[model samples]
Target: MTMIAVCALWGMLFSVLLAEPVQAADLIRALMFQEAQRVLITSGRGLVRQFPDGAEQVMTTPVVVTQLDGGMTLNGARAASDMVKVRGRDDDLIITVAETPVSDQPQDRLSDKVSDAAGSAVPPAELGPPPMGALRGPAPLHTLVLAGAVQVIRRGKSLMVINEVDLEEYVKGVVPSEMSSGWHLEALKAQAVAARTYALYQRMMNAGRDYDVVAGVQDQVYRGRRGVDERVQQAVEATRGVVLMHQNAPVFAAFSSTAAGPTEDAINVWSKDLPYLKGVECPFDANSPYYRWRAELSLQDLENNLRRQGIAVGTIASVTPFSFSRAGRVGRLRILHSEGELILRGTDFRRVVGYTAVRSTQFEVQSVGRTIVLAGRGSGHAVGLCQWGAKELAELGYSFAVILTYYFPGTEFNNTRFGAQAPSSTP
Candidate 1:
C-alpha cells in the first residue's frame, strides 16, 4: 500500500513538472502599453509644447524643462506661451504629452520621428542649459488634446512643423545607418521600455551610445569571419548551458553569439593561453580596450568549482553575460586599474578555488595545440535574446518578441495575459 501511494505521488509530480509554457495569445493581452517618462507634442502647425506626465495636466505655458549632462535636457511645456519648472534632484525630465503633435502615429513612434523627421516641425529649440532658478518663474497649467501636425524647434523658442515622411526616412536611412545594427538598438529599447522618468531615458541613451561604438566594431569583425552566414543570428544563438555565478541568485539563459566576442575571447585566453594570472597582470598583447581584461575559464574549471559547492555540472553551453543579471553584474567583481595591469576584485569567486580574477573579457587559450588565448569579451554566458542584440535584429526585420523567442529555445512566444504562460498548477 505504501509503495503504491509513493508511486502515485511520483506520477503526479512528474505530470506537474511537464506543464506547458504560457501561450502566445495570452501573453499579448497581458502585455500593456507602458507609459513614457517624457513626451514632446506638436500642438499645431506653428505651436508646440511638451507634457512630462502622461494625461495629467491638460495644458501649460512656457514649458517645463530640465538639463542633463552630456547634451540632454527635459522639456516640460504644455503650450507655446508658458512652461512649468519641475524641481528634483535627478537631472532628467518626465514628459507626459506634447502641445503639438507632428504625426498621427502613437507616442511610441516618436523615436522614429526624432530619428528621421524630414524637416523641422518647428525650428529646433535654441538648446542651452536653462539658467539656474528659472524654475521659480510662474507658469500656467491647463488641459487640451492636441490634434494634427505642428512644427517645433529642437532648442529654439519658435514653433514649427516637421515632415512625418522625413522622419520615416530618418528612421530607415539615417538612424539605422548611424548606429550598430543589433545590440545598441536592443539596449535603447530596453531603456525606453524600462524608463519611468526622463533622467532614466538619458541614462539609457548614454549607455546606448557607448554600447553602439563597441557593438559596431564587433559586428564588423564578426561578419568578416569566413564561411559564416546569418552571422548575427548565429552569435545570438551561441550562449547556452554556461553558468554565470553571481552574488544574486543565478540568472540562466542562452545569449546570442554576436554579443559573445569580448567575453569569450577573454575567458579563452585566461584559461588556455598563458599561465593563470595572479593579481593584476595585463593578459593580452592586443592593443585595444579589450586588452585589459584578466580573467579566464573553461568547463573543467567551472565544474570543479561547482563540485566544491556540491552542485552538479549542467550541460556545457556558451558562456555569455546574458545568463547573468540584466545589468550584467559578474558576482561582485570590481575593476582596478594601475601600473599597466588591470585588476578585478569582488565576491565574484570568493567561494571558488583555482579561478583567478581579471576585469576585461579578454582571455588566454591553450587547447589541442592551439596555444592562443581565446580572450573572451563581454561578461555573462552568451545566450538567448540579448536585449540589446535583439533591438538591432528588430531593426533588421525581427519583431520585438520574435527576437526574444529566437534566442530562448523551448520557450514559446505568445501575447497572452502572461506573454508566455506556465502550465496550470491545478490538476
Candidate 2:
C-alpha cells in the first residue's frame, strides 16, 4: 500500500481499538457516576403527549407544563385535577385521554384579600402558609408536574430550578434553618448546578455502562474534591420546574453536602511572591478544568508525603463549601482560589519536571474575604486532566488526538460515539 493509504488505515485501526470497552473492574476503579438531574429532553413533546389523561394542559406555548396539584380554596376555590400537558397551537391539539377528576384543595382565596380606602389590592410576602381551606385537598401526583413550575417566582435576577427534587427540599427545609446563613440561595444554586451537571454527564456517558470513567477522570483531576463547571450550570437550568422530593416536600441543595459546611466569614486571596506572577498571566475563570488539575497534583503530593510520615492524611477532596478565586505572579503560573483559601498554587518552573524543594525564597497564602475560601496552587488539581495544559499543548499545534492523550494519559476518546443505550452488565 502507498504511504498515505497506510497512514489512513493505521489511524482507522487505532480509533477502533480506542473505542473498545475496557475491563469492567478497571473501568469501575477509574469511573465516577452521579444521579441525573436537570435533564434536557430534546424529544419531550412526544413524552408529554404520551401521558394518559386529559389532565395535561398547555397553559402557555411550546413551553409545555402540567399541574401537579389543584387550586387553593380559601373562599371556596375548588381543587383542580392534577394533569400534565404539552403546549400546542390554539386549536390543533387533539388530546385523546379522559379528563381526571379534580382533587381541589379547599382554599378561602378571598378571605385574605381586603380592599383599602384607595381600593388597591396587595399580596403579603408572609401570607403565612396557604389557609387550611386552601390546602383542603392534595392534587394527584402527575398534576404536580405543572403546578410546581408555575408556583416558582423569580428571585433577584435568576429563576430557581424548582423542578430538581433535591434542591426543592433544600429550599423548603434547609433554607429556613439558614444552613449556610443568608447566602443559602446563592450557595445552594451553585451547588445544585454543579451536582445536576455532574449527574447528567454521568448519565449520558454511562447510559449502559458499568461505570463513567470520564467522571472518574474528573474526580482524579480534583483528587476527589467537588469540581464545578459550565456543564453543571446548564443542567441546573434545563431541569427547572421539576420538583425535587425530599421527605415529600420541595427544597434546595448544594452540589455536594460536604462542600457546604458551616457558614464561614470572608477570606482574602494573597500573592506568594512580591511580583508573584513573574512570567505567567492570571487566568479568567477559576472553575475551568485547567486549574483543577493543578490542585489534584499538589494534594496528591501532600497525601503521599503525609502517608510516608505515617500520618493518616486523606486525599484533598474538592466540592467542600467554598467560593472561588484565582492567583499567581505576572511571569509565574496562575492558580485557582476558593473563598480566599488557596485550593491550588502554581509551583516554580523547576517543579513541573518532578523536581522538589522550594526554589522560591518566599511562599505565602493570601485571603480575599468570602463566605467560603479556597486556597492552594499549581492551578488545577495536578492529576490526569490538565485542560489548560492540554490547551497549551493544543496551541503547540498538536492534534486533538495528542491533546486528549496527554491530558487523559492512559485513556482514549472514542472516535465512534456510542448510541444512547444502556450497556448490558456482566454480572
Candidate 3:
C-alpha cells in the first residue's frame, strides 16, 4: 500500500481501539441446555427486535421473565402461544407478538430508577445495588448459548434486554472486549481485575434495572463467548475474585487505551475526588499511536455539528481553547459564533464535535482558512489506569499488582466474590 493508505489504516485501527468505552445494548438468542444456577441479567434493551434462530426454525415461543422476589413474580410471561417483539413508543413501551398488540404498560409508566443497599443514590465513585436485586443465571459451570432464551422487557417507552450468564463467564467476555488479547499477561491480568470491578460496579449502579452493563463500550465492551480470547481467559482466571479496593469499596477504576503523559486525576475529568485516581507520571505509553496525532474539521462542519447537538452557536466565527486541565487536556473551550460567544467544557465539546476527532484533552488548537485543526496527544478520559502504560510496564517485568498500583495509588487487592461490597474507608 502507498504511504498515505498505510497511514490511513493505522489511524483507523487506532481510532477503533481507542474508541475506549462503548456502552451498547443488543441480543440474538438465549438457549438453556442446563439447569440455571441463579445468575440473572436483563437480556436486551432499547428499540430491539428478536427472532428465533438456529433450531427454532422460524417458530415463535412465549417468553417468561419473572421477578426474583418472594412469590417470584413473573414480570413478563407471554401467553403460552404467542411470540412478542417489543418496541419503544414515545414515553411508553409496546409488546407486539401477534397481529394485535397487548398493552402491558404499567400504570405508572415510570422509568426504572434504582438505589443501593442503602436507599440513597450511590456516589459516582461508588457502585450501588439495584432496587430490584440481581437475576439468577443458567447453570453455574456451563457455558450459556446466549442466543437462545433472548426476551425483551419494558422500562417505560424504553425496551431493554440482557444476557443472563454466570458472573465469571461475563468477566471472561470482558477481558478481550476491553483490551487486545496479545498484550503481556500481567497487563491482561490488570485489565481483568479492572473489568471485573467495573462490571460489578455497573451491576450495582443499574440495580433493579433490566441489565447491568451494555454489550458496547459505554460500560466496557463485552462480546459474550465470541469475544473471549484464550490468553484473556487465562488472565481472568488468574485474577478471579481479585478486585481493586479503596476504603472497602470498588474504585471507579476508569481507564484509557493510552495516557500520552502523566495520568490525570479523576476530579479533573468527572468532578469525583477519588483518592486513588490521582494523576501520576506515566512515561510508558509513548508507543501508542495516539501518543501524537492530528485532526481537522472545516468551519462549516464545526458549526453544523454544534447545531446538530442542539447548541445554537450561530455561524461559527472562531473557536478557542478556554482552559486546560493539569493533565494538559482542554478543560474548557470557547466558541465564537455569529450570535455570541459560548463556553463549553472540553469533554462536552468532544462529544458534540465527535470524540475521535478531539481524541484527547491534551491538544493544540489552530485555524487555517475556514478549517480548524486539533493536534492532540493521548486518547480517552485521562483517569485511572492506562492500558498501554500497563502493557509497557508488564513488558519490563512488572506484575499485574505492580502495574495496577503504579496507575491507581493507595489501592490494595482484595479477594472477593460477585456482588460483594465492604464498608467505606479512607486511604
Q: Pick the lDDT winner.
A: 3
**Each prediction's number of clashing residue pairs:** 133, 108, 40
Model 1 C-alpha lDDT per residue in residues 1-427, reported as the tens digit of each score:
6999976775565334223321112100000001112234322222333244532333343333332222223353233332222211212222233232221111111111111122111101111111110112242221222112212223334222122111111112222211232333433332222111111212223433311111011111110111222322233222211111111111122222223222221232223221111111111112222223444455456546655767444533333221222223242322111212222222233234321232222233333321122344422222222333444454455443334433332333111222332211111
The models' CA-based lDDT, in order, is 0.26, 0.25, 0.57
lDDT at residue 183 of model 3 (Cα atoms): 74
Give the lowest summed-lDDT range of ten residues in model 2: 256-265
Q: Pick the candidate with the highest TM-score.
A: 3
* Reference-based TM-score of each model: 0.24, 0.24, 0.65
lDDT string, candidate 3, 1-427, tens digits: 8999986775565344323322223121211211121222223332333444522222222233332322222234333322233222111222211110011110100001111222221111123211112124221222222322344443332233444555566667666645667778988898887877666556545656555665443455454565565887799777766767665555677777677888888877778898898988888878776688799989899888888889887888888899888877788999888899999888777767765566677888899989988888877776888787877887877778877776778876664322212211111
Error of 2 at 44 (Å): 17
